[model samples]
Target: MLQSLSIRDIVLIEALDLDFGAGLSVLTGETGAGKSILLDSMGLALGNRADSGLVRQGMEKAQVTATFDAPDPASKLAVYLADNDIEIEPGEPLIIKRSVKADGGSRAFINDQPCSAALLREAGNRLIEIHGQHDDRGLINPRGHRALLDTYAGSDPAKVRQAFEGWQSAKVALEQAIADQEAAEQDREFLEHSVAELSKFAPQPGEEQELALERATMMKGEKLTGDLEAIRAAFDGSNGGLASLRAAARRLDRIGEDHPLLAEALGALDRAVIEAGEAEELLNKAADALMFDPQRLDDMETRLFELRALARKHRVEPETLAKLLTDMETRLAAISDGGRSLKTLEAGLAEAKSSYIAAAEMLRLKRQKAAKALDKAVAGELKPLKLDAARFETLIEPLDELRWGGNGMDRIEFLISTNPGAPLAPLGKIASGGELSRFILALKVALAEEGGAGTIIFDEVDRGVGGAVAAAIGERLAKLSKAAQLLVVTHSPQVASKGDAHFLINKSIAGTVSRTDVAALDGEGRRQEIARMLSGADVTDEARAQADRLLEGV
Candidate 1:
């Protein structure tokens, strides 16, 4: 509920602080007593648009602050405040302040934390609902009609909406799958050809590296084999080189048995001959090792070139060819099996759609029943508000095709006929200003408990109404206050008498500055104010007696 409102330098209101309470509270004063200014100040605190003209003549800026008490610690407003990085002290009122400068620069704050005007408006919406003669008529907007009906119905349309969305999603998925399958079918021949070609090639992992190594070895062997052969030829030198040298060394050794120096020379020559024989054996073994088959080298080079050609044709690296072949094989396999899978998906989509239709049909039936009850309830309220000859109806029309939306398939609207035999029309299209305000009151009364906890302020709901009808309007407002906090700005004595609290708005001039002042009334003060509302600029004994009776009745 709105706990208090503070205004500073806003038009006629130089400075004012008004505390509010639960139940119905009425603000009444003479004409031009700045009642509109008060409401506008409240609107500013609720994040309405600001203008430099709203500032007082001598003031540099205008400011309005509103405070509200949350119904719970975890209310939606609390969560919203936290989400916007606005701090709220535990068990403390939520304070919102808006200031406008003479230059039209404006700023908004939540709990003293600077914030955007948009965020302030959203937060305000969660705490209070303001309905003026013109603003209350907004209830006739068709866009909000469905939601209002849903609230009155107390039915959870979200379940049906979720079902419809699920069905739509399934249908989309099935359609996409069918389109893909058709495209794949068109390319079946090409896929088969590619798969067969890759299979025939039968590439292996690391095969290119192995083949390159073999080719390199074979190319080096061609040069190495010739060198080995030359070494073997040299070791097998002409004219018995090693054999003659060994025979000479033996003869010298037998002679040199008596000569030590000659014996040493012969020994050295024998060692050289032995070394030559070992060199010949090593050359023969090396030549055999370098004698690789030329055909083997040719086969390796051919395999390596074939692999490289395939890599280029497929636009893949040689190492990636194996993985690519695997992928192609998988794609071909999917194409072969896709027809069956597509059919399965189609069937599943059909089932989901059927489920959604069943749920939506059930929801539509319930809404129809709810709409009838709501019509009867609202109709009951019209007669006392002097609309006895009028007819109120809640029209529910089921859409021909299912609509995937946050709400259900049925469109709900509030239709009314002001006179007997008159054709019913949409509320906004036909209802007059007075009729719209009464209709809003009826709806609010019908959905009082269901409406979220908040302060409801009605600015002149009694407009175009007076006498007994105005009294009836006051009775209804008082009834509504029992369930939700209500504030009414009015000139009707009948309404003022019903208030749990009364405030008088009056204007005064102080030191060349004009200011609007608000005074809360007690018992006698409340009576005098109500009397003034009854008699208009003059209080009479009869008006006081009437005001007393109205208060007693309240």
Candidate 2:
């Protein structure tokens, strides 16, 4: 609900403040009493187009601020605010403000955060609705018709959506699988030959490096083996220097036992014998380790060449041949087992399709039932609003295949025939303004509990209506206010009499400047205003008595 509005230097409103309340608040005034000024100021805050003309003649800028009561924790407006990351303190009012400069530029803000007019407009849409003779811009957008119908029918649309998405996913999966199977079948012969070739070779990971190392060692060993043998012979052969040294050491060991100098010579001979023994062992090991074969070298080199060639043919490193083998085998297996896998996918898709069809059919049936009830309810409101000749229908025609959607295969549109034998067409195409307002009224009454903005404003729902018809409009407005605040600008005293709060808009001149001010009427003031409305520029005693009678009934 809009709690307050402040306007500064806007057109004829120099500075003004107004407070609103829940329920039906009526603004009544003589013609051209700055009623349009009030609407314009509110439009600024609601993100309507702004220009230099909107600023007062002597002022540089015009500003308007509107404050709204915080939305319920679970309301759509609250959800919208949260989703947009709009900062709001705990229990803070939702404040929207707009400023227009003489230069024809404007700025908008929400909760004091600088924002764009589009965002402001969206937020305003969630909080308020302004309807007039030429406007049914709130509940009649046609997009909300289906959702409102579902709400009226009390059906679970979410479940239907889930079923639809499940079927769609299954369908996509089936198509992808069929495509893959076709591709694999096209390459079946190639896959078979590749798998066979790789199987025969059975190349192992890291084998290329192992084979190359062996090849290098064998090739090098053949060139170095002779040199290694000469070293071994020098240490252990009988005609080598080691043999002469050993003979001299043995002779010294036998005769040097009696003297310290001879003891030292014996120890030195022992050390030399030990050193030679160690060298002989190492030399034997080295000579044996050089066992080489040119044939083995050729075999290893040839095998390595084959691995490298295969790797290049497959566009992979030699180390990855093992992985390629596994993948090719899997592809072959899939090709062999394609029919069974495709059958499984098709079966799943069929089950999902069946579930979706069932849900959509149920929704269709329920909507049909709901549509009939809505038509009857709206028809009942017709005669009182002087629309007895109009006929309302909910058109639920099947959509074409290309237009099918998750909501169902039905295109729901509200159609009206304003005269007997006239073809039914979309409401916007067939109904007059008064007829539309009545139709909208009946819809609001039917969907009063379905939920909408916390406030709804009507420029003149009673247009072209009078007497009991006008009273009925007032009654419905009051009834709607139970769910949300309602403000009406009306000329019917009967309608004005129904207001929970009444305001009178009047204009006056201060020197050469024109100014407009809205006055909240009390009991006496309301009586005088209603009397003035009942009469013409005069509050006759009879009009006052009639006004009292009207207020008393309310």
Candidate 3:
């Protein structure tokens, strides 16, 4: 609830600070007593648009501050403040201040921390709802009807919202998968043929270098074989040194026993013969290895050419062809399995849709029951507010499939008929301004404990009807106060009499300046104020007696 409001240099109000209490408080005065100015001051603090004209003459700026007793720690105000990085202690006062400059600029603050006007508006809306000539915060707007109805029905709609989101996610995934499969399908045949070709080629890493070395050796094999064989023959052939060496070694051995000198020469000749035999063996091995065939070299060259050609055709390095084959095979496998994957996602979507439907159905049924009770309750209030023939209803109907949302499939509207035989219609077409004010009061009374701002300001809610109707309006306002604070601006004496606190709005002129002043009335002050409200321009003994009776009842 609004704990206090302070205004400075705002139009007729120079400086004023008013403390408010719980339950209903009434502000009363004659015409042009600055009652509207008081409300304007409050609106400014709540982030309403401001202009330079609102600043008092000669004043640099106009300021208004509204302080509220903190809402529950879990309230929307707390959430909004947290989201904006504004910290406040629990149970502390939530202060919102707005300043309008003479230059057509404005600033806002929440809890003394500088912030945007939008944030102040957000926090302001959670603290107080002003229902005036414009029903901006009322149920006339269709957007809020569902949440308000949900609050009255006492059902959890978040579960259905969550289910709907899950269903949407599944649908999105299925669509993306289908698109991917369609793109892959365009290249299916090419992928299959490529995979098959690569599998057959079976390219190996480092195979190119090995093949090149072998081709070089085979291409020059004829020349190398000839050179090697000639060298072998020089050492191993009978016409070569091996046969000669054997003949000389045998002769030396036979003569070595006849003379010591011949023996020493035979020893040297025998060593030379052994070394020549070893060299001939090595030459024979070399001669055998050098015997190459052209047909074998041709086969090797043909294989190397195939590898090079295949590498070129594939547009890949010879070593990476193996990796390409593996990747192509994997993509083909995924595409082949896409149909099954899509089916799985479709099943998930169906399950989520079913869950959402069940929850929404349950919520709609409860809302239907709540609507009936609400209509009947509001109907019960109409007769006392002088709308005895007025009909009130809660309209709930299914929306189109495409228009369905997280709120549910239901579109809720409040309809009314002011006279008998009148067709029930929307709030705008139902009645006059006075009738609408009474209707708003009835609705407020009925949804007294529902989710809403902590403070409700009814701007002349008892505007039309009088006598018993005014009293009934006052009674209902009092009833609403049991759950939340209320600020009622009214000229009705009955309504004014019902307030826990009464404030008199008066205009005073000091020389060239006229200012509006608000004073909380005491006993005699209350009597005089009530008497003035009862009898305009004069207060008589009879009006005082009536006012006394009213106060005595309170």
User: Top TM-score: which candidate number?
Assistant: 2
Q: Candidate 3 on 505-554: residue-level lDDT in tens?
A: 99999999999999999989989888887887889999999999888766
Q: Give the CA lDDT, 0 to 100, for residue 454 in model 2.
A: 78
Query: How do all models score by TM-score?
Result: 0.86, 0.93, 0.82
lDDT of 2 by residue, 300-359 (tens): 888999999999999999999999999999999999899999999999999998998888
Error of 3 at 182 (Å): 1.4
Those runs of model 2 whose alpha carbons end farther than 4 Å from true positions after fitting are: 241-253, 256-266, 287-291, 510-512
Candidate 3 is scored at a TM of: 0.82
lDDT of each: 0.83, 0.85, 0.85
Could you tell which candidate, 2 or 3, scores higher by TM-score?
2
Clashing pairs in 3: none
Q: Report the Cα lDDT for residue 36, model 1.
A: 93
